[model samples]
Target: MGRTMGLDYGDKTIGVAISDELGWTAQGVEVIRRRKPEDDMERLRQLSAEYGVTNIVVGLPKNMNNTVGPRGELCIAFSESLRESLRLPVSMWDERLSTVSAQRTLLEADVSRKKRKQVVDKMAAAIILQNYLDSNSKR
Candidate 1:
């Protein structure tokens, strides 16, 4: 089966992750610097093809109160765009504090600040994807 792709979309970047063939785990791929909507979609399309992605899971940044804010709305819009452009089923998973968790994991790994900055988004994407996979497996 093709892998599930995970995305962490932000104002400046879009982090990418992909599940293993078995869909048991996730790995950080790349952090695409955002330019234009079409450009981002094109890059995502390339990644999807390269990784043989069957589906997409986008990280939705919700507030602590479990309500979607402006960022979450943006993610929802992005996901809609992805569905139309990629013609793949797109799902949005709650991603509150995913970045924070990534930062913590990086800190524990003793990664330098500059290096962490470069990879944090991708790392967060992996975490978001892993969480989704784990939850689904338990179902």
Candidate 2:
């Protein structure tokens, strides 16, 4: 089976992660610094081809009360663009606490502040992807 890609799309950067070939686990790939939408789409297309990605999962940041705010709407729009560009199924996963969880994991691992900042987005992507995998497996 082909692997799935996970994305944590932020204002300044997009975190990328890919599932294992067996679709078991998620691993951080890299953080793409946002430039232009076309540039980002090209980069994503390249990564998808390189990693044999069959689908994409984008993290959707919602408010604590489970409401979709502006950021969430942006993510939805982004996902739609991805779907149109890649012709692949793009799904949004609720990522309310993924960033916080990633921060805690980094802290527990003794990662330095500066280092954590560099990798937090990608880590959050992994968390989002892993959560999706786990939930889907239970069904």
Candidate 3:
């Protein structure tokens, strides 16, 4: 099976993660600096092909009450676009506390605030993907 990609889409930066060739583990890949839609999609297309990615797992940032909001709506739209452009099955996994969790992790790692801001996006992407993999894994 081809590797799966995890995306943490945000207003300014899009964090990227990739699953192992075996699709068992997720690792931080890169943070694509947001640009025009055309440019961003071009970059994603290239990355997908480079890694032979067949599936995309995007983080759905739902509210604490498990309700969809503007951000979640935007994510759904983004997922739809990705599905059409990439021609891959796109799935959304819950990302309720991923950012917070990532922040906590950064604190534990004693990452400097400046460094954490730079890397947190990618790290959050990894956490989101790892959760998906862990839940879907079979013994």
Off by over 4 Å in 1: none
TM-score of each model, paired residue for residue: 0.98, 0.98, 0.97
RMSD of each: 0.6, 0.6, 1.0
lDDT of 2 by residue, 19-128 (tens): 99988899999999999999999999999999999999999999999999999999999999999999999999999999999999999999999999999999999999
lDDT of 3 by residue, 18-120 (tens): 9998878999999999999878888999999999998999999999899999999999999999899889999999998888999999999999999999998
Return whichever of 2 and 3 wins on lDDT: 2
Alpha carbon RMSD to native, model 2: 0.6
List lDDT for all candidates, in order: 0.97, 0.97, 0.92
TM-score of 2: 0.98
Q: What is the lDDT of residue 52 in candidate 2?
A: 97
Candidate 3: residue pairs that collide: none
Query: Residues 77-130, candidate 1, lDDT per residue (tens digit)?
Result: 999999999999999999998999999999999999999999999999999999
